[model samples]
Target: MTTATRTLQLKAAPLIVEAEKEKKPVKVRITAYTGGIMTVPGWGPVIIDLQGLDLPQRVTLLLDHEGRTEATIGWGIPKTDGKTLVIDGTVTEATDAGKLVIALLKDDVPLQASVGVETNQYRPLKPGDTITVNGQTITVESDTFLIEGGILREVSVVPLGADKQTMVTLAAGVRNMTHQPAPPENSSPGETIEAKYILDLLSVCGDDMSTFRQAIENRLPLETAKALAETRRRPVIPPVLNAEVKDTPASILAAAALKLLGKESLAEKELGAETLSAAASYKPRTALDLCGMACQMSLGYAPRGTNEIIRAAFSTTDLPVALGVAANKIALDAYQQAPATWKSFARIVSAKDFKEHTGIRLTGDFKLEELAAHGEIRHANVGEETITYKVTTYAKMLMLDRQHIINDDIAILDQIPTIFGRAAARKVADLVYTVLLSNPGGFFSAAHSNLITGAESGLSVASLAEAIAALRKQTDADGLPLDLVPRVLLVPPELEATARQVLNSVELYRSGGDQLPAGNPFAGLNIALEVEPRLSNTYFPGNSTAAWYLLCGPADGSFLVAFLNGQQGPTIEPVDPGADKLGTGWRCYIDIGAAAADWRCAVKASGA
Candidate 1:
């Protein structure tokens, strides 16, 4: 409010006076401001003392607030009528911008007025404070500064104004409005919009000076100029491309490896049909050829020698990642092909991190209690038992030397990574079987009534029935029968045929001197047979070919194989090869753990 000067723009409707149709100069009357309390943006509430308002005999009327010579519409004599400041003016200019005001007046359209003032003397007032100005009692509802003394510099005709109650009037039928020369034929109605108005609009839309100059030169309408400015203001967006350009170099290399292995069909299936078609182009390349491509793509030059190519490729980021991804794909394929007997009898779960994962078993109170009539059922606190385990990182490194690349052996890439994958799978299987064979916490014991040993406890129809019955008769933490069923028959590789025969045969028979056939009760039971070679391997501390187990489905929470973050297979990572090293190296690793979860769901036979 204390700024050097401030302009308060107010809207006014032109009042049509008595007709002067033959007059050469059209005259009009306007109430610039119905002086009272007005809210000015930034300045807040402002009260103008009408008596202190200074007026000139011939105040220039400018278009908007440009103040240029061409913007002068005409001059007007301003006077006060106790409360409102009125202006009597004439339409005396012929400029295109001024003509818009003349046209509005000639057609009896309303006009707006804005008065610029210089604040010379003022008094600030607090809320609810009363002050006397020009014999009128004014009580401010908010903090405001009263303009006790000010000079009315000039007035302007704007398309829109801040205040909406003032009025402007044109004499009726004063048809010959323009008193000056006509505009050129090239001029347009868009010219009526002031350049400053257009500039302000462009500035709001974040347009440069070039765009503003274009709008002025072309004399574009307000809406059209706004649209152009908006279009240029938007952020630029990039276009989308197909897989050949979109896919990473690593993924492309993996697809190419599949192509080299003469398994192009699998490559399409492994990576969607559209995935490898563009990158591999149905062609295969050796390890050496791949290194050369990587060098050319990354270093922008063809490889010189096999040794340099291998060194340079290993040095670059994309080449190592590409090689790692290719190796991982091959390793994963082999890992899947390798047998994992644990999957059939144990549940597979994921660990989030190295932190120990607690498996909570809810029991006892889970059974619903009876409810009384018109009474709510009470909540029960179920019994909980937890087992904790954490995943461990297992890894090994493989080095691919210059000679290996020089020989251009694709088989090395295929066989080495495959071995790593199988090894990783074997590691997981070993962990799971170790926990089972260790019989941690007596998982299979006489106290639990799940372990059986006798002459008839060997692999036979009667032994399977007894094991299944024992598993089904097992109790919960509260001594309630779990009602479990045998879903899998686990045995050593040596007993695979016998175990299968026990479940698949239509009739069972004695293996001793007696060959008489007995009834096969397990023939119709859909029990899966899983044979693990490690169960009988001497590498383990307790290896037994004659020992076998009957287990419940994985959902019964008998045992679980947990992989970190659900990454079931191993991952291959490239190692940085420094100056001393002559070859590239990759470390393949897996995060995994295993443990026996519950004892009630499994029954073991000694087969003595």
Candidate 2:
């Protein structure tokens, strides 16, 4: 006769159980392999047995959901006399036969699961053994187990969280329920998050959320926000509490709350409104335009009528920096407009390209000698000399009243920079001119360089001709004739008429001569007469009203004027606003030095 098959249905309850509360059971479908375990949601697993039911019968089993238990099966029908068969146990110790000595606890009695040599392949277990049976955790507390015929006997068992002592002992190996919870959605693992990313997240909450989110997000510190909010006159309603509000994005919630309290956004407010408008309207053209755009953006913010605020915002712009730029432009214009007076007669050299200082070497002149036929040539050592000069910086400061900036009169503000620039130009011209005229010894004193022989009589055709002859006859350090020709006749304003008459005349008259038939010795001379006021200025030491110079070509290096290479003219810069007494004044300066490098290139005559 064929035995009919039976169906055994299995189900698991939630791991946490309250006897009085009802919970829906999770159905467990058994597959062909009964060894596979099934788990309950928010719970552990359960093992089922489907082979024991009688044919055409339905059986339901209720399993312990929260307490400790071992894997087992009942050998008889429900509610009938039957023996319970235990299959799992806690390992107590290893036996000499290489088996795990196990014990089962049932009604406080001991049963053993050791099979001696037959269980030799099983790993030897130690006291405090941990093992899982049908999702229930079990621990072995003793090394000894009462065993009968290789079966598991009584063993001590404890629930995982039944007591504080058990939790403390198991916490090292497992994550205890008291450990910190996992990160929430939209949260990261770092201590801080990017502001932009936070802003983006707030945007996702909704446009209206901006008011609330901006309150907290715009504030630097929570205390500051609180203080600002406390000062507001109007009472703000606290946000409504609900599921959606509770779940609102963190950034949006923060900003919205701040908006409600009427706390200003520091970042937005600090950037002035004018700057923001400028930035929005600005279109970048060159690389400089890009810089301009950045300046506008940096200064852009809420509008405040205070001059300090407006100036502070503008301080971040290129305008203040442009002050120095304007100064430089002014200096350049001044240098370009340099008078056609002294510079035309003096050699000008740039000093800026020099790293620390510049030097002018005056080499001794070389002399030519007739060479002997096939004989060794004699070498003459003309020692070299050097004159070193360094650049000096000059500066001036100007101030603008705080009230002027407040008025926002750009026209008034503009004039100061231009004035500063023009001032720098004037300073440069004055410096170069002073250096050229201040030293009379470079021209009139023979002891200076032998460029002058002795004090000549008053300015006249004969006196001028004598001075030119002296310059032509002068020799260099090598005792060779310099072949110098006087090109410019430098004089004071008092002698202009005499210089013009002497140079323009076609003939000369001698007061003591009886009769002389000859052409004018001063005629057809291409000498440019330059009248400089500083020549007779009493400020310059040793300058005489009648002192005059017959100067050679500038290329001849009779006098040298050096300027810092790229900075051939004065430069303008803003005084450090913090250090300046004049809050709005800028400084203009020039770096320059001048000296007569070689006096032999000109002849000086102390006129009577």
* TM match of model 1 to true structure: 0.57
User: What would the per-residue lDDT of candidate 2 be over residues 1-608, giving only the tens digit for each residue?
Assistant: 84433222222111111111132121221111121132211111212222221111112111111001221111111111112221221121222111111111212232111100000011223455544432233344433111111111111122221122111000000000111122334443244756865574444333333232433333323333333334321121111110111111111222222222232252123223332233334443322232233222222221233433434333321233332333344345545665546565667777744345545554564666789898878777667555455556665555544544444343333355456556555565556556656654444356644343344557876788778887888876677787888889988899999988888867666656548755667667778888877678787665678878888887887666666654465544433354222234455555666665667777677787
lDDT of 1 by residue, 1-608 (tens): 43222233334544433336677355767667676566543234566787876564357776654434666777777888667777787756467666677777677665666665544445667877876654456677777757666566566676555435322211000010101122234675354766577667676546344345555655555565566656443311111101122233445555666677665675676665665774475244677777665544433333466666676555444555556666777888889999887887788889988788999888865567788787998776688888778898888878777777777776777788899999999999999989999999888899989899988878977788899889888887777778888899999888888888889888665677876657677867879888888888999877898999999888886899888878788877665444456666677888999989988889999886
Q: Where does the lowest 10-residue lDDT sum fall in candidate 2?
A: 167-176
Candidate lDDT (C-alpha), each: 0.67, 0.40
Off by over 4 Å in 1: 1-245, 281-284, 303-308, 509-518
Backbone clash count for every predicted candidate, in the order shown: 4, 29
Candidate 2 global CA lDDT score: 0.40
